[model samples]
Target chain A: MTSSHLVYLIALPLFSSAFLILMGRKADKWGHIFATLISAAVFGVGVSEFMAMHSRAGDMRAVTQHLFSWISVGTFQVDASLLLDQLSICFVLLISGVGTLIHIYSIAYMSHDKDRRRFFAYLNFFIAAMLLLVLGDSYLNLYVGWEGVGLASYLLIGFWNQKPTYATAAKKAFVANRVGDVGLSLAIMIAFAQFGSVTFDGVKAGVHGASPAALTALGAMLLLAAAGKSAQFPLQSWLGDAMAGPTPVSALIHAATMVTAGVYLITRSNFIFDGSSTARLLVVIVGGITLLFGALIGTAKDDIKKALAASTMSQIGYMILASGLGPVGYAIAIMHLLTHGFFKAGMFLGAGSVMHGMDDEVNMRRYGAIGKVMPITFATFGLGYLAIIGVPPFAGFYSKDKIIEIAFNAGGTKGIILGGATLLGAAITAFYMTRLMVMTFAGSKRWDDKAHPHESPVLMWLPMVVLAIGSVATGFLFNSGNSLVNWLAPVLNPNNVESGSELMKPIVVSSLALLAVILGVALAVTKYRTVPVEAPEDVSIFTKVARRDLLQDAFNETVLMRPGQILTAGLVKTDYFAIDGLVRLIGAVVSGTSTFLRRIQNGYVRSYALIMVIGALALIATIWVVTL
Target chain B: MDISNYLYLSAILFTIGAIGVVVRRNAIVVFMCVELMLNAANLAFVTFSRINGNLDGQVASFFTMVVAACEVVVGLAIIVTMYRSRRSASVDDASLLKR
Candidate 1:
């Protein structure tokens, strides 16, 4: 709660990264030690913060560490203060907790990488940036961390720069995010213009006094910024492209920490969003579309990591849904975030294990009947699938199921849409997951004889095994109606955990969702399992309509891509002509001057004297006119 | 005329020197042109000091003159070096790039 405690979270990693970089070429050996220690300690501090928050859940603890006055002008002041509250704690937990797992996993994942030291250093750097992002009390400070996370993501995504595709993917993620970041910067300008303040506390107060139209516009614009960062709907295409990065990074920035920043921003300004139903509805609608889209696309992908990425997109949809539910749903959304962090990290690591053994072959078709060879990996994979599918008694089931109930309780068209959309996504989730599980783990052997797929090293499996436990236990935390909700009763205060199950009639909802999950498993198993255990790499219908993401990529290529290329060419052409035109004009003037001046070199002394006389006469005439 | 008129006249002279530096092909002329712009700015600084009844402007001008003198000496030294090395002061012909 003191300044030192707040300072430690940031300074520990910041200094260690500096120390690691200073070690130069010997960075790998020393860098690993520094990164692992800092992340674990930060996670410890986060746990303490959560405990502290839990103790005082009813009151928002304004833990401020005022480093100095950041800005001071004519009636404009903002402190370089770090804030600790429910919001900061939630982010701190995500950054440090998921961060710790990624750090450990990297020790194995990047052990053979030549730039292992640099990898650890970048990981630490991202954590520090993410910390600053969450802990900053003011908009300007948050933006510093916001843009910093963007820089870290860009660097880490293309860690293997030898591949041009990796570099392009990194650039795509960076540039696309910049488009949304502009809205954030503009929104900050608007906030400053209308309210003359930028602190979280200040802006919240200002919103109360602001016009409804202004509030709605500001809220929607801010959510747009969040949507890009969090991979919601229109801005989500870059996320699929982000598979070019290391899998551990997908677990960290893409899944756990960085993408959730959008929700953090919106939820922090819960007061502002509550004022505008339109803004809230837009949130629900966008979230619903992304959830359904991501899961469907996820179902159609063969690259193991890309499938997880699409699933990441879908999971973030649930977070957006929770955020739109306001504060009551806020706790559930964050809990969902926490549980998703564990399971998603584990699933990615498990996929990494399978890839490691298969010599980087991630296509599930090459991996059939892997359950016998790698039992541990298979078990963790099964737990992850269950957690993700929201099977009863798992963390994903509780958190995801709660979101569906929240949607139904909100009532009206949106309620029905969210509730229905989430259920439908749940079915596809089960189907694709069942299809994937059977193809990868349940069916007969498929790999070549020389390729011996085995369990990952214990270093990797430890994290997966632990997270599998978390995914199973976490859902039950919320099972007794208000159990999970009551845990955070301190934050939302006196309001009893809205028995959402009661309101939405959880019995019917659960049975229906349960039935959907069952149906998905049944159909996928019936079609693929008994057919000689030979899941076709390309079923004609699956090939035409499903696998290439229903021709989204193809459609983008012909419909969006060709036109985009032409437009880019046209812009370049216009730019080229305009620039070349100016260059030629300047060149012509210079050459013309050179030509005109050549007469001076014609060896004509008498003519030169005659020109001097004419110049003198002209000057005298001008002077005489002025004198007159 | 007010002291500002002298400074204003110096400015016009400086501009003429600047154009000579640009228009001429001799290194010495360009070196002399830079001195002219510095002196013009210094003269304006002093004029404004008197107009405002302050001494800070004059003090700055004095320092500017000292720096400008040091710069001129350095500039000539470099030109001398170039001449010794290349045996030419015609700035256009001193294009070692072509060689």
Candidate 2:
């Protein structure tokens, strides 16, 4: 296929977004269908592009579509271009394919809303932006897509803007992302200064010759950017609150597509990370800490979406940690990323289905024995849960377990620490996820009288079922022949590292992971299966802190927010009392002088003539004095 | 016959016209005094032309005369309109600009 066809992948959604927005409420009747069709067409184009690239031999698998000269200065140039390579192709398929499903899901999820058309428009906009992000040839172009998705996410998260808290949540997400964006912007600037190019290929080729310190700086800054987008540690406070958005938004932007941009970025820039051990270790550290942090918070969240949101953060943390493990970890990170997309989106959609049946109620404590009422949701959510906890034969097992095995093989004290952390993360993941499942589906009925639980429409359950199947089978398929790893070999593992290294036997790792899962499940089932419906008012300090997201809010307040508030207040005072007062003083001086000067006019021709004569005399006297 | 004498006579007439413009209350009288200043400037221009042995100053005086005639037309029209409105010709009485 010609590289020009790549435009269709980006243009389809962009055009649909423009169409939906321009048509406004007039297209409400058919907007969702139009958006879904456009997304499906984009997915078809993505599949065809993948096939075309696959048919090509070796390096030719990567194609660049040069649109125009974007920027040009002496010895510096960037093109408006798109690259259809093995790595980007994966993202394109994931975004468009999964995006189409979410679009279909949103149709049913948002059907009752008055502004559903606008929501669909924003979804299309998001897909277009995400497509731009993965497909862009340069860092600058990618940034365009990056900010585009940010705006789209901001719009989607506040889709129900009538709620003040929802709007605030949207603002919070946007602001947190902006913090990371600054890091990305600086990274690009430093990259240009160091290598004189911001193109992915240019940087990858040039990065090896660069100073290790520079490479480490680049990698660290990139990690910060990833942390913001993927909701990693320190920047994670926004993800749980982002649950205030519509469920489809949580499923698509938060769980599936947008959040994975960070993983894609680190994986795309693998060359830089490969060169700098310090940078790689930093990536691992961020990932490791965030995984534990998110999982701990997940264990305490009562809101179903927020629980899933925390789970999403922890899962992304795993992917980030994996990406930090060097070449072997990059491929595995992407593998986990793809599988996580399927299962997380499925699980979030399942959460939406429950809320739909339970009169939009979100508290998991209020949900019980829902499995009997909505078997499809329970079954899909159960598959996703099993996948997430790394149960054998499920998608997460192949991807996540590989990461753990690789972490163990990383060697010495660091390896053991990383491995142990990942294992602990896994057990905690299984525990919290199991608690969520039991509290939501398996226990005695705790639903209020008003909620009449029922199966969602076929439209909603259909996507969940598809994603659930993906959650079950994708891991085995991808890991079995090393097909995914091989397909991605040209871009990700150019040296073709043999994919068989385990510090411990494969059976041992799998057994250990399975043991953790079983123990977690057993612990949760015993504790929560017969527990009271309402959350107990009194809890341990740890639980309280975890419930408050490990005091992240208070920390943010003390560290970032409070100082910002005080600084703003100080500036406001200075503006009012000092700067503004000075301005007022100048105004008073001018007015007072003008009032005094007004007497000189006196409204008489004789006075004006006399003043002009006196001014002329003064000028003449000055000139005469100077001449003398 | 000496050019300096004409320059001195022009300067004295210009000063007298300036004082008349400043002291006079009647708009017609002030207008006449402004014309006198223009004539005085014309005299000085002619004297400078003779002293410098050039026709440039004489040419400038002609241009000034044309401009002064245009200014008279515009100024008299404004004065006539103001007089018609307020029924007064004294320069002090036409001080509608006083705040």
Q: Could you say which candidate leads in TM-score? A: 2
Looking at chain B only, the TM-scores across the models are: 0.85, 0.93
Candidate 1 per-residue lDDT over residues A90-165, each given as its tens digit:
6787689778877887888888888888888888989998999889888888888889898888998988879999
- Who wins the DockQ comparison? 2
**lDDT of each candidate versus the true structure:** 0.79, 0.92
What DockQ score does model 2 reach against the true complex?
0.58
Candidate 1 chain A weakest lDDT stretch, 10 residues: A601-610
Clashing pairs in 2: none
Give a tens-digit lDDT track for model 2, residues A300-344: 999999999999999999999988888888889999999999999
> Which regions of candidate 1 fall more than 4 Å away from where they truly are?
A1-3, A53-57, A60-62, A478-484, A487-504, A530-546, A550-572, A575-583, A586-590, A593-597, A608-628, B1-99
Off by over 4 Å in 2: A497-502, A597-628, B1-99
Chain A TM-score values, per prediction:
0.90, 0.94
Alpha carbon lDDT at A559, candidate 1 = 82
